[model samples]
Target: MPPLDSVLAGFADAFTLFNLLFVVAGVAMGQLVGAIPGIGPVMAMAIAIPFTFTLDTLPAVSFLVGIMKGGLFGGAIPAVLINTPGTPDAAATTFDGHPLAAKGKPLKATKMALYSSVTGDAFSDMVLILASAPIAVIALKLGPVEVCALMIFAFAVIAGLVGDSLIKGLIAALLGLLLATVQLDPEQATPRFDFGYFQLYDGVNLVAVAVGMLAVAEIVRRMAEHDGRPQPAAVPQSEEPGARGVSWREYWGCRWTMLRGALIGTGLGALPGLGSTAAAFMSYASAKRGDPGGVPFGEGNLRGIAATESANSAVMGANLIPLLGIGIPGSVSAALLISAFVIHGIQPGPLMFRTQPELVYGIFGAMLMANLCNLIVGQLSLRAWSAAVKAPASFIFPAALIFCIAGVYLSSGGLFGVSIMLIAAAVSLTLTAVGIPVIVLLITFFLGRRFETSLSQALTILDGDPRALTAHPVALILLVGALATGVWMARRR
Candidate 1:
């Protein structure tokens, strides 16, 4: 770990006026996009990434983190107001949130969500601040052999858990791995699959791919799904006395439920590919099971809203654990962040701690600041964001598409990048239509080169001798874990 003084300085660095403005702006923008149907934080972040090219690293990352934290709560706005989830992770919130809205308590329901969201986000960020360095220290001791095995385990677990069909998930992961091999081979000086394009020699632009797959593709999908009719506006909140907000007593009542949900989210978020959607649903289910008599979950229960929002929001911070610790992205959002880190010439891994401890600690500080910004911005703008849920898909999708094109073009520095983005969008759309999870493909593509390089080095060390694996107990254990996960998935299938 860095010296205590260094950590303090890093935290202080995040308090600059420029950084604070970015955090507030990011949080506000995130909530607006998240409240508008079909434009969640992931898409917003992907579209906004290129605009951060000239920003200092700390402010840029802090802005993205702010968006992530704000979006978690903003998603609940539509879930409560319109019976539509703004993001997949907010789907669980609809179970109880909409019911509460129907009862003329839209304000109360949303307030519960915002409070729990901030609490869980702060809890997870604290966990990340405390745990990431130690995990990275331990990870630094592993050799290529162990890293290779660990990657295999990560892939196995990701494939098994991401989508309903394990076979389809595996296929998507393998396809990503193959596509990642398009650049020059690591060992050989020659390009492996450049297809005669010089741009391919340097590999596909990560920003283009991420923006295409997430932002542009989703815009197209939403536009196609629109029925060319104006949707109903959000439910009007109660104007009666004492009905416009959640009281401290009500918020304090669900404290244990929020804590349990936060714990579940943090645990699941640290693992690769499970995603916040799963965490929210799992936490909701657990809350339901544990509280059989209180408000009867799924029927306007404050506890249900607390459970889902807390768990999903907790995921924002906890998902960074693996990325900072071992250089593996735990979710698609984190994969996009990896591109951001790379763009700023900072590689995330154990060495990052040794070489750029200040940056890492600053990121931690920014995360905590984002939580505060999310809460403040969300509270002050609840009614405004709730109203934004009525935004038309036609206008939003086209505008977002423009941003996607512009962002990718600027980041990639050419029309070639735009072409790649269009192609990737087409591919992502097709995959989504077929029920294949695009997230699995994107994350595997992001990590493929590292996995392949580690595997190659491990093999060179072994020299074709299978028995040599015995010398690396960590690798053996990880490989065994991978095999076990595969078998378990097969059985479940």
Candidate 2:
């Protein structure tokens, strides 16, 4: 544990005026963006990264974290009101949320989502704080061989969990690995896939690739599918007295469901690459299984709303566990956060606690603060977000496209960056048009370089001896586990 003074200093750092402003701004933006269909927290974070390049570390990260936290709950607003999930994680919420809205209780459903979201978020944040240090301690003991095995295990797990088709998921992951091999060789300085383009010598710009695939590609897809129609009004019962609020009895009745969902979310999120969408659905399923005949699930059940919202929102904080403890991002949002950390000269891993304890604890403090900010801002901006969701898709996508381009150009510093972004966006769109899972590709791309570096180091330590693996039981076990999981997933398919 960090000393009392260090912890206090960290909280003090996160409590600064600059950090607070960014947090509030980020929450507001997240709520707005998330309330609009076809826009999500990942897209918002990708676009926001460029603007953060000029800010100090704490404020920049606080801003992004605030967005992620707020977006979790914000997504449920559209799900409840219009039956359109603003983010993938909120899809399960639509099951009961829209039904509640149909019954003229949209505000009650929205408030249930809000309260449950904050509860789960706070639960996961506390778990993150309690678990991160111990996990980091164990992670620090891992050798290069063990690290390599762990990476392989993560790859196998992600490939299995991401998509329905195992073959497609594996293909996507392999393609990401191939793309990551571009630029100079890790061992020697010789360039590998530059194609004689001088600009490729430094490899693909992380910001450009990330923004293109996540933000620009989505924008392009939405634009390609655009109809000249405004989205339906979100709040169907905006003026109905019966839909005004949720009572304490209604909220407390689903406490067990909320707690179960939070636990499910936190557990799944700590594993690398199993995302919030999965958590939400899993929690919803569990709730349905446990429900003892009350309003019926999928037919305006408050418990169903509580379950899905809590689980999905809980994932936002829990996903950071792997990132902070083992230096592996569990989702696209965490990957963007890792990029932000790198941009600020901070490296996340076991040593981060020792080398930058203040910064790490400051981030913890900021996360807690962001949850509070998310609740307050989400409540106050409910009407504004409902109004904003009515904006035409034609207007939103074009503006988003412009923002994506500008953000890439500004962050990467020229036409070269813009070109890279455009190329990446094209490729991402092409991949998505097929049966491929672009999310798996993006996650693998983020982790590939680290896997490669660890593999190289492990091989060097082994001195080219194949028998050396027998000396490390942990690595052998992890590799075997990975192989077994892969085979099982293949058979299940």
Candidate 3:
């Protein structure tokens, strides 16, 4: 470990007035973009990158980190309010958050998310500060074979947790895998399902797929149900103390759920390619398995919100571990941070610790400070978002639809993305109408490409030799676990 005095000095650097202001501004801006459909923190950070060129390195880096930490909570706002996930990872949040809102406890649901997000982020940041190097070393041992086996376990868990019928859930997951195959084959670099559309050569845009199925579909369904009628104004939560907010007792009650989520997220985030969306769903599935009789997993359960928010938020801090220790970008956000570091002439890796110890500790301090900022900013913004949900249904649905269209168009795919979104929305509605689990399908689709890439790489490495599996104990264990989980779930159902 670095000398105690150096750590203190680094923290002192982060406490400067300029750094604090940058963090605050970043947190506020992050929440703004995160609450809006399609404009997540990744895009916000990308836009803000050029602006940071004039600033000092610590403040500039802190600002971006603050934005990422804050977005974790902000993404849950719309998921809780209107059944629309502001970010793809927040899709899991919608399973129970929107149900709570419909039950007239929007404030309670949002508060649960806020508390869980901060708690998980703080836990992972502490882990990053103390044990990042060791964790990254362990994470490096997980090769393509291990990753493929892990994805199999994830799919098994999710299929069992999502819907009543195991067969239906598996079918939806298969469809998602099929959708992911539309892109050029990872190994061959040849298109399999593009159907001669040049635009599809790059495959379907994730923003379009996610926003369409989660946001546009819900908007269309609600509009059809109401038939243009104005909804009654939501009653003010202040009128009822018992139902308006989460209590300290309630937060304490979910301590185990949050801890499990944080652990799952940190572990997954340390590995490159596996992302927060998968972590969130995995945590949710675990929580559901532990609680067979409580709150039904998807119907206004506070623990559901806690599970997803904690896991996704934890991912942000844990993603930095590999970047700082091994110079490997664990996720897209970490990849962006790599550019920022390189622009400042700082190379990430073990040598940096000896050369730039103060800067490293300062980054750690900034992460801790960002967590506090997220809490304050998130609490302040809840009222504004709550009021939005209170607007008449006539106004809410129309505005949401407009945002969905605009957001998809502004995404990388442009007009083509918008078209894909419309089609995906229709498909989402059809699947829901037929009693299929849309969340399972969505999760599998999000993970399918990575799973395929890993499987192909694993196969190449093993050269079709069954004996080679013995050398990869981790992969063998994971594959066995996947089979066991599948059988366990099937029997339980």
Best-performing candidate as measured by TM-score: 1
Which is the better candidate, 1 or 3, if ranked by lDDT? 1
Worst-scoring 10-residue span by lDDT in model 3:
229-238
- Could you tell me every candidate's TM-score relative to the true structure? 0.98, 0.97, 0.62
The order of the candidates by TM-score, greatest first, is 1, 2, 3
Off by over 4 Å in 3: 133-238, 385-493
Candidates in order have lDDT scores of 0.90, 0.88, 0.78
Score candidate 1 by TM-score against the native.
Answer: 0.98
Which segments of model 2 are wrong by more than 4 Å? 234-242
Candidate 2 or 1, higher TM-score: 1
* Candidate 1 weakest lDDT stretch, 10 residues: 233-242
The clash tally of candidate 3 reads 0
**Candidate 1 C-alpha error for residue 263, in Å:** 0.8
Instruction: For candidate 2, write residues 440-468 as lDDT tens digits.
Output: 88878877888889999999999979689
Candidate 1 on 179-263: residue-level lDDT in tens? 8998988888698788889898877888999999999898888888899988786676677765678888889889999999999
Q: List the residue pairs that clash in candidate 2.
A: none
Number of the top-ranking candidate, with lDDT as the measure: 1
Ranking 2 against 3 by TM-score, winner: 2
Predict model 1's lDDT versus the native: 0.90
Q: For model 2, where is the 10-residue window of minimal lDDT?
A: 233-242
